[model samples]
Each structure stands twice: as C-alpha cells, then as structure tokens.
Target: MSPTLQNEALQSRAEALGQSLPPLLAEAEMLAATLMLGEHGRRRAGSGDEFWQYRAAHQGDPARAIDWRRSARSDGHFIREREWQAAQSVTLWVDPAKSMAFSGGRERPPKGDRARLLALALAVLLLRGGERVGLAGLAQPRSGRSQIVRLAARLAGEPEAGDYGAPETAGMVGHGRAVFVSDFLGPIEPVEAALSRAADRGVRGALCQILDPAEEEFPFDGRVIFESMSGSMRHETQQAGELRSRYLARLAERKDRLSELARAVGWQFSTFHTGAPAQSALLWLYRALEGGR
Candidate 1:
C-alpha cells in the first residue's frame, strides 16, 4: 500500500476505535461495579475491615498488636490479621495478531476488540481489588487505577511488529499470575511453550479463549470463501454447510488440547464468545484468581 493509503487506513482505524471505546469502558465499569458488590472484592491482606484471623502475639509484636476485646476473653494476647499481606501482580496479554481482527458478522465486535475489553475490564477489577496490573510484552505490572487509561490507549493503538500470539514470560519474575486473552485458534505449540515457561517461573494464571459466535457455531451455509488474515492461505467451499461438522470437530479438538495444556501447567482455561455478556468471562477470571491456582 502507498503511504497515503496507509495514513488513511490508520486514520479510519483511529476513528472506529474512538467510536467504540466509550461504550466498552462504560460497560466494563458497570460490570466491575456489580462484581465489587459481591465477594469478588480484594482477597489480599491490606487495610480493610474484614477479619481474617488471630494469632498469639509474638516477641516482635507491635504495641498495637493486642486486640482488646479478643485478648480480654483469651489467656494469651493475640494479633489480628486481615488477610495475606502480599498483593498479587497479574500480567495480562491479549492477542493483537491479524487473525484477531476478523469478525463473523457486521453486528459483532471483532475478537480483538472483545479480548481488549476483557483485558481492560479485568484490569479494572484487579486494580479495584488492590492488585497490580500490567500488559504482557508491553508494560510492567503496576498498581493504581491510573494505569487503566494507559492500558486502554495502548489497546486501541495499532499493533507493533511481532506483537502476536502469547506473551513472553522472561520479564515476569515474581510469583504473580498471568492472564492470556486470545482466540487460541493457531497452532498449540507456542501457547504450550509460553505457559510452560511461566509455570517454570512459578507464575500461575488463567487462559480465556475469546471467539466470535459464528466461529464457535460454524453458522455458515451455501458457498463461502475463507481467506487467511495474513493472506497466505485461502479456501473456497461450495457447500459450507457440509464442512460445519468437520470444522466444529477440529475446534473442539483444539479446545480440548488447550484445556489439557492449561491443566498441565496448573492454570485454568475458559472460553467466551463475543456475543455473550462480558460479565461472565470477568466473573470466571476473578474467581480463578481468587481460587489462587
């Protein structure tokens, strides 16, 4: 493409993103608000009202360690703990590969958009819960709600070169979790490899497979021409209906393999369709993190 055409394309993309972002952010915040009302609140030990436990005051116990009411009833003085002290860091990665740009219908959002929304919403929830959030291969895990807008901006921007597939785990050094949001439609080897490396580093996390409704249902009929996002492959089917069964079978096989890989690495795996409510995926992710797997 010529430079002028490239600029026009970029401008068009920017405009589309601007139109879509407000709704996405609003929906995400609404979902987060609902989740906050439930038990999905922060589980980490921090400044909170909920009671965790009480233990015998030790030698290094601070002067404020005594719980007056509880200590009065007990022979030994005890210190109260709200919860675990360390706040977890979660690294999120949404596949920005060309394939994610495909949408089955005009009404449906692209898989990439859905993935970005989920990643951002999940980040919102995590930040609210006092956990650090970071974008895999892009940003370092950091705390505070301010990072949310920065993440949103990066998601709307064009993908950088080599920004494809699962993220690299080399920079994830702590015992933090990693969340991978993607279609996971490509070969399984790279996914497996990336999860393996993170597992080796003691980073447990979850995998969310975002798919278009048509992709999951294979709702095509009659004639159809399928072209690869990279334009490297093409297939034409005269009876698209006839291929549905085979396509579905292959998709199921892929999901099964992904599940097995996730299990092997002690990570959780779940699937979400763009047509479904985003809250469901966010809830599942929040629970998975709470489960501390």
Candidate 2:
C-alpha cells in the first residue's frame, strides 16, 4: 500500500474507533450497573484471610483454629473459618479478527461489539470486587476505573486481518483465570494449543463463542456468494440452502470440540449470539468465575 493510502486507512480506522468508543463504554457501564458489586463469596472455608462464618469446632480442629470468645457464647467450641479466595487475576481477550465484525442485520450490533461489551462489563464488576482485569497480551492486569477506559480504547481501535481469532496465552498469570471471547471459526489447532499452554501454567478460564444469527440459523437460500470479512476467502454457491446441512453440521462439530476442550482443561464454555441481550452473557461469565472458586 502507498503511503497516502496507508495514512487514509489509519485516519478512517481512527474515526471509526472514535465513533464507537463512547457508546460502547456507556452500554457497558449500564449493563454492569444491573449487577451487585463486591467480592464474590466462595461459600466454603479455606486459607483466605476474610472471615466467612463460625462453625462448631470439629474433633480434629487445631487449637489455634478455635475461637475462644465465640466458644464462650456458644455451648460448643466454634471455629472461625475464612472463605476461599482464588482466581485473583482475570485476563480478557476479545477477538480482533475481521470475522468478529460481522453482523447479521441492522437490528443487532457486530459480534465484536457484543464481545467487547461483555468483556468490559465483566471487567467493571471484577474491578469493583477488587480483582485485577486486563487485556490478554496487550495490557497487564490492574484494578481501577482507568482500566475500563484502557480496555475500551483498545477494543475499538482496529480489526485484525483474519477470518478467525486465536487466544494469546504467553503472558498468562500463573493460577489465574481468563476469559476469551471469539467466534472460534478458525482452525482448532490454535485454540487447542493456547488452552494447553494455559493449562500447563495452572490457568483455567472461560471460552465465550460469539456468533451472528445467520451463522447459526443458515437463513440464506438460492444463489449466494460467501466471502470472508477480510475478503481473503470466497465461494459462490448456486444452492446455498443445500449446503445448510453441512454448514450447520460443521458449526455443531466446532462447538462440541470447544466444549470438550474446555472440559479437558477445567474451563467453562458458552455460546452467545449477537441477536441476544448482552447482559445474559455477562452474567454467565461473572457466575462462572465465581463458581470456579
């Protein structure tokens, strides 16, 4: 590309990002406001510092673990237990692939937009709860309102040139959790490799597959030209409807594979469509993280 063309492309991308950033941030905040804030309770006693509850002292309970004052008030000896605190660092990855920019119609936003919204909203809740959140491979995990702005800017900046996206796991926090948002239309090797690396580091997380309604329902009929969002792959089919079965089959297979991979690595997996409300996915991600603890 010529210098003039490259500059023009950069300017266009900047303008697009500027246009999208404010609404994305506003929507994320609104979505996050609907949820309760504070550190999520693990509901079980472990090695955490925060006191969860007082239970009757067990036969084998250590003398130091007993609460003498509480025991005096109670008929039986009591033990103060601390809640389990795990997954301190949460890394988020929203797919930057051009395919994630696809939307089925004017009514719904792009898959990438939904993914970013979910990621940011979840971050807001996590940050409020004192969890460090960051963009995978782009930013170090930090907790603050400022991190939300940093994430939104990065998410709206530019689209990657590819048909699909892959997770970046090199700098993953050991024993920390991660959330990866992608369409997962790419080959399975990259996804498998990334999760394997994460597992090796004792990192477990969630995989959110964002898709367009058209991709799942296969509403196209008759002749259609199917081209990738990056314009790198294309196919002209006279009987688009006839290929629906094969396309749906492949999609199901991919989803099954993702689910299996997630299970193998002790992670959670979910599928969300652009047509649905974003809050549901955000809620699911929040609960999944809390449950993992």
Highest TM-score against the true fold, candidate = 2
Q: Write candidate 2's Cα lDDT for 1-293 as tens digits.
A: 99999999999988988898899989999999987655666668788788999989889989998999999996899999888765388888888989988998999999988998999999888887778888988888887889888888887767787788888885578898899999999989989999999899888899999999999999999999999899999999899999999999999999999999999999999999999988788889998887766
Q: Which residue pairs collide in model 1, if any?
A: none
Best candidate, lDDT: 2
Off by over 4 Å in 1: 1-24, 38-50, 53-81, 160-164
Per residue, candidate 1 scores C-alpha lDDT tens digits across 1-293 of 99999999989998988886677777667777776644335555566677778878899879686797888997889888786545678898888887788788888888888888888888888887678888877788888878887777667767543424655664575678998888898778889889988988889999999999988998889999988777767899899999999999999999999899999988999899988887888889888877763
What residue pairs clash in candidate 2, if any at all?
none
TM-score attained by model 1: 0.80
lDDT of 1: 0.81
The superposed Cα distance between candidate 1 and the true structure at residue 81, in angstroms, equals: 4.5
